[model samples]
Target: MTMKDPKSYDLLSYIVVFLGFYEGVLPFVAKSTDWEPFLSLPRHLSSPAWWIVSGLVIVASFFSLWGIDIAKKRRHPDA
Candidate 1:
């Protein structure tokens, strides 16, 4: 089967990575600092919904990277 655009996958991987970092960091920052809106975020992060979201982010990142790898392999099979 043919792969989709590698650049698109690469961009998506970058975005997912950024989001994963944001999700993981927000609660820590919220707890450690005095930001008003951020302070409440940490409390909600303990919920199952946040966990699921984080999991999905991780999965998306993994898949995107995998796709990129496949595309690179297809592009340079001899490497």
Candidate 2:
């Protein structure tokens, strides 16, 4: 397989990580603390749709980080 640019993966991973944090972690914290969320989101945290979307974002972030690791390994097998 043609190796992808690790920098691209790095950038994508960072973005996904931020999204995961924003969607998954931030909402619960904001709701508990009575602080306004940074992004406008569904007010009902108990909604199944909200949980599903947040879970997907968190999973995607994990995969993105994993992709970066795999790309780095492909670039430097000896390291």
Task: Please tell me which predicted candidate would have the highest lDDT against the true structure.
Answer: 2
lDDT of 2: 0.68
User: Candidate 2 residues 1-79, lDDT tens each?
Assistant: 3445656656666777787788766766676787877473633556677667666766777887787778777886654
lDDT of 2 at 62: 82
For model 1 the local lDDT of residue 25 reads 51
Across 1-79, the per-residue lDDT of candidate 1 in tens digits comes to 3335556545666776776556645544554584535433333665676656655655666776787677767875654
Model 2 weakest lDDT span, ten residues long: 38-47
Residue 18 in model 2: lDDT: 82
TM-score of each: 0.47, 0.62
Residue 58 Cα positional deviation in candidate 1, in Å, after optimal superposition = 0.9
Task: Note the Cα lDDT for every prediction shown.
Answer: 0.58, 0.68
Instruction: List candidate 1 segments past 4 Å from native.
Output: 1-13, 24-46
